[model samples]
Target: MSNFLSGISITLSAIALAVSGWTAYQLSQLNLLIDQQQNTITEQQNTNTQQQDKITQLTQKIEQNKALISSDTTQQLNSVSTTSKAQNNVIQPGQFVRQGFDNKIKIELQSVKRIQNPDSEEKNVVVVQMRIRRIVPKGKVDAISLNQSRGRNPETSEVYRTIQNKSTSFTYINDLPQDSWGNAYFWLKVPEGINVIDIVIPETAIFEAVPISS
Candidate 1:
C-alpha cells in the first residue's frame, strides 16, 4: 500500500508541473499580443498627425490664391477704365488742363516733360507737375497726399515709384487756407524705349497713356 501511494503522488506532481508550464506559455503570448496592439496604435496616430499637417498647408495655399485672384481682377478693371478716359483726354507737353472735382477741388496738370537726369544724363526721366486749387471757400482737402501717387507702365504692366527730386515743389495742401492752391511734382525713372506711361492717383484720377516726348 505504501509503494502504490508513492507512485500516485509522483504522477500527480508531474501533471501539476505540466499545467503550470502551459499557463506560463499562454501568459507570454498574451503579453506579446498587447505589445503588438500598442505599436499599431502608435503608427496610426503618427499617420493621422501627418495628414492633419498637410490639410492645414493646403488650406493656407487656397486662401492665398483667392486673395491674389481678387486683387488681380480689381486691377484689371481699373486699368481698363483708366485707359479709356485717358484716350479721350490726351494732354501733351507744354499744355495745361483742368479737372474739376465736385465743383470744390480743381486739379490742373501744369506740365509733363521728359528731362535728362541730373545724376545720369544718359538716363531720361519723366516729370509731371500738378496744381491743386480749392475752389469752394468752405471745403478743405489734403493736397500733399499726392506724394502717395504711383506711375504705371501700361506696356509692361509694371508700376514705378514717384521720386521726389530737387525740382519737385510740393506744398502741404492741408496747411493751406481755404480758396488757396498748392503745387506738387512727380518724377519717374523709366526705360529708354518706354514711350507711354500712366499715372494713377488713388481716389483722385488716372492719367493713362501719356506720351514720353524725347
Candidate 2:
C-alpha cells in the first residue's frame, strides 16, 4: 500500500508542473500580441499627423491665391477709371491753361511739341513747356512739386512715365519770386508709330490727343 501511494503522488506532482509551464507559455504569447498591437497603433497615429499637416498647407495656399486675385482685379479697375477721366479732360497742344494754388501762386502750360531727336533720328521726343509766376509777394509757401509726367497711347490706353536718364530731360521751376516769371521744360520718349498720345500731369493737367510730329 505504501509503494502504490508514492507512485500516485509522483504522478500528481508531474501533472501540476506540466500545467504551470503551459500557463506561463500562454502568458508570454499574450504579452507579445499586446506589444505588436501597441506598435501598430503608434504607427497609425504618426501617419494621421502627417496627413493633417498636408491639409493645412494646402488650405493656406488656396487662401493666398484668392487674395492675389482680388488685389489684381482692384488694380485693373482703378487703372481704367483713371484712363477714362483723363480722356474726358483733353487739352490741345500749344494751348495755355492757368492753375493757381490758394491764390498765392499761378502756373501756366505754355506749349507742347513733339520733336525728332537731334542725335538719334530714329527716336522721337515730346517736349512740354510751362511758366510759373507768384501772385503774393510776402506769402510763405512750399515750392510746387512736379511728381510725374506720363504719356498715354490713345488706342491702347497704355501709360508711359518719364525715365530718369541722360537722354530724358526734366526741368521745372521750384520757387518763383514775386512778380517774376519762371520757365520749365519736360521731355519724354515715345515710340515711332504712336502718333496720338495723352499727356497727363497727375492732379494738375491733361493734354489730350496730342499729335506727335517730326
Q: Which structure among the candidates has the greatest lDDT? A: 1
Report every candidate's CA lDDT: 0.70, 0.67
Taking all chains together, each candidate's TM-score versus the true structure is 0.46, 0.43
Clashes of each: 0, 0
Error of 2 at 175 (Å): 2.3
Displacement of the residue 171 alpha carbon in candidate 1, Å = 4.2
Return the clash pairs for model 1, or none. none
- The alpha-carbon deviation from the true structure for residue 214 of candidate 1, after best TM-score superposition, in angstroms, is 2.7
Best by TM-score: 1
Candidate 1's TM-score = 0.46
Tens digit per residue, CA lDDT, model 1, 82-179:
88756544565345444444445556675666778888865667787777776566545544455566778897789877666433444444454456
